[model samples]
Target: MGAGLAMQTAVNAKLRDFVLSPYLSSGFSFLMAWVFLLLLNLVTRQPLLISGTFITHNPSWLWLGGFFGAIALTGNVVLFQKIGSLQTTVLPIMGQIIMSILIDQFGLFQSPANPLTWAKGIGLVLIVSGVILSLGLFEPRDPLLKAAERHAGKGSQLFYQLFAILAGMLMAMQTAINGYLGTTLHSPIRASFISFTIGVLSLILVNLITHAHFSNIRLALKQGPRYWWIWIGGIIGALYVLCSSWLVPLIGTGQVVVLALFGQLVFSALVENFGLFASQVNRMTRAKIIGLVVMFVGVLTVKFITF
Candidate 1:
């Protein structure tokens, strides 16, 4: 599932190249996922509508999971194009870890409460240190870092970094909210479908407000046969969403998030090192390897180390 999330970022980044607008690319991705989920729900005989009494009883904020998802997905598409896969992956991960900690500690969004502990605190510090190492911050001469500094001014670069972290935070929130929604809806698939439906609507509103060009959609379709892989992004996204919703209920959100983060970190490293999906090649250095090891340890500490 985490690998799918990383691939979704790469695929959507490529899709943005053809679509010429992040909003459109993300909207199309959500649309495809929505359609796929809709079909799956139909085939599986899942109910599309829930009772108004159920709706009235639950908090309205529960429905905003898809809204948060739309922003996070769109933000990832934009960040991947701007910061390369490595930064795009790690920055959001930092935010995700922090947000997941908050959710677990406070029982936010109706998730089970697991208060913060010294081990968890130490784990977070290690994870942050690992992220810094993975980013090659100590090596001032790294090619990717220099390139980013040269291309985007310090102000713009900082903005993108912050945005990436914000996107990750929203993703964590979306997971928790969708988990509760799944419990309420009694079907993870239905929860996924609802999430995608709201995501589509959110993207549509954003596209309309931004006056995004619709012509690019036509161009993408014309070029679709040659770049067939781009279309699979939505399918992958659908699966990731379904898995998260399903897993979060069975396991805790923090566990599911950290496990997914592990998958994302490993797969994204592969994507960066190998230049998969036509992305830029950013070789994994020794520092990055050590950083990954530290992160793995941190994840273990957070998951297994008790009071």
Candidate 2:
């Protein structure tokens, strides 16, 4: 859990750097992650550390899952730049709560549990209300008045918010894919390694086609991007995806996302207000404070109110 928090912090910081494109950060992060995992394997002398069974047994799900993961990463990194970390993170909670209900109740994704009950229903409502409060969606005025107002305007902010929400939905897809993959594939690490590598490669291709910033690439490699801290964001993303894929099967995707949301609330508060590790400290507002509390309550209810 601590490791996941650290990785997420790295991701948020990378987004703030406003550096060599979101795609670049994501791709580079995966490349770096591949290297990081390899290094660990080399140092520990554990060839089995990240097994090959993931590819041998069921290659299709890894590829399919990688596709959604790429989308999720692109949306999340961009949304982080636009909507701020806390707001962006909350969007996933909303999607996961909804998706979990449908998937679990109907066995859409072949979830271990089936047929959602009243407890889950009530928990979902609480989560929805908490998201509204946390996001300040219910407030009449711009909920983020104290925070940096979107330079783009209402339409732009709305677009960014939607991007954040879409990122969440894509992540939910990735969770289901990973859970399915986990069952057939023996090693979680190997499956994660492959999925991230494919996703990262895909992002690179897309980025080169869209932007084709050869000059920026040269500069980033040499001196690093303007905000190099953003690289940590990639590292965080790599670790988070790997671990999340591993954990979600054991616990449901809904539970894992809920836990992650709780972590985001605390980490985002520190990142935005206190500026931990020299990160930007966005202004806090009264509505946001109240919203944070509401989110906490929602998390507690979701965790304990199991049917």
Candidate 3:
């Protein structure tokens, strides 16, 4: 899922000019995935269902995972609700950075070996530091934070911490895998469709075993261009997968990851301050500005410093 987020920027960079209406390509890719998933449902005997009531009452943007710290943590979300927010946030990010360094060092998942350079290593450390500092993850906890952990009932959650860290490592692995698949297929659109289709099947199988139920299925999807931005999430998703696939072939994997993170931080600030695309106004902070600058430098150092 993190790779899914990182890949779109690469897609935008790579395929923006080469393709005829890249978003349209993205749309078709999603459509293909849906068709594949629909077919899978036929053989698998699990209808793609949803909770109609749960979605009907929520703001539409919630579907895009904009709530961030809540669902982004997933399994750790429950743990986060138990432990303080800082530990949960910090562990995964630290874990991801550590794993990405290893992935680059070993050239995992068909990646060309981009052995860790001194500059790259230092930059990654700075990036991690900035992430922790900007989020105040290292700051002292307040009473509310301590109170919130009551559900966890005051015990060492070493297990969830390790689990969260492993999840971050898995994200790094996912990006490499996606990049490899995209390169092999020679089409980001096809690669993304395949990824999405597989994801749908995987989730459906999970739901089938769990015997999950939903209040309703959201069937009122519209493809009109005017309403395009609303469903643009799908386009962005397919586009990112395509971009990552294309980028891995050129820049190796870690640089793609760094550049994508830099891009996300830059644009996310813009969206938050201006309330673009129905996003919330997060008002950038001094620390956040510092963090972005540090991250940008890290990205430049990682990508441009040819050692």
Candidate 4:
């Protein structure tokens, strides 16, 4: 699922090229995923309408997963423009790890309570260190870091950074909430469809408010056939969402987040090394390899070690 997410990122980047607006591309992607899950639920004989009993009995927060997702998507775009991609990536990850830990420790969103242990603490540190190393952040002169530094005033930068962390926390909360929603609905597929539906509606509102060029949608359709691969971003994203909803209940949210992060980093390294999808070639360095090893160790520590 994490690898699929990385692919979705690449595919969405290409889709953004055709649509000429990230908001439009994201909304379109959500629309496609919504349609896909709608069909899946229909074929699987799942009820299209959510029962009133389920609605009346469940907490209202269960329904906010998609709204949170939409906000996170929008936040990423804004952060990408305001802060460099490096900070955009790292800050959210930090937020995700921290939030996931809190959720697991406190049994937030009705998730199972798994109090933090010493081994888990060590694993968290290693995982964070690995992320920093893999991104080459130890070098004070990294171009992306310098670019981010030049982009904002100190106060504004701190605000954007905090917003980025909040976005990440929202992402983790969304996963946990959706997992519970799936259990309540008795179908992860339906939960995914509903999530996408809400996300699409939210994005539609955002696009309208921002005056996003709807003309780009028509342009993208005309040019879409030439780059058929871009259309699959939504499908990939749908699967990722479905898997996250399904997995969270089975293996706590923290594990799901860590495992997915590991997959994302590993697959992203391969993508950069191979120069796939017209991405720039950045051959894997020793630091990246060492970081991967550390990340792997961290994953094991978190997953298998208890004492």
Q: For residues 1-307, write the lDDT of model 3, one tens digit per residue.
A: 3433433323322222222233333333344445654564456554344367845854453232111211222334243333323334345555667777787799766567778998878777776666656554455667885686565554556667666667566655665565555455454454445556554444454445655432111221322344333333445554555566667779876577666665555654565456444433446567667766775676566556766
lDDT of 1 by residue, 11-127 (tens): 999989988999999999999999999999999999987788988999998999999999999999999978789889888988887898899999999988999999999988998
lDDT (10s digit) by residue, model 4, range 1-307: 7777666666666677778788887888888888999999889998888778888998899889999987786666556546534445555766776787899899999999989999889988987787667656565566785776677566887798899889888988998898888887778888888888889999999899989998887776787456788788788888888787678879976577668876766676676678666555667777767877786677667656898
Ranking by lDDT: 1, 4, 2, 3
After superposing candidate 4 on the true structure, give the runs of residues whose Cα lies further than 4 Å from its correct spot.
75-93, 140-165, 222-226, 244-259, 280-283
Q: Considering TM-score, where higher is better, how would the candidates rank from best to worst?
A: 1, 4, 2, 3
TM-scores of all candidate predictions against the true structure: 0.93, 0.78, 0.57, 0.83
Judged by TM-score relative to the true structure, which candidate is superior, 1 or 2? 1
Off by over 4 Å in 2: 2-18, 39-62, 138-151, 221-228, 241-258, 276-280
C-alpha lDDT of all candidate models, in order: 0.88, 0.64, 0.50, 0.76
Q: List the residue pairs that clash in candidate 2.
A: 7-236, 10-233, 11-233, 14-230
Question: For model 4, how many clashes?
Answer: 0
Residue 289, candidate 2: Cα error in Å is: 2.8
Number of colliding residue pairs in each model: 0, 4, 7, 0
Whole-model lDDT for model 3 versus the true structure? 0.50
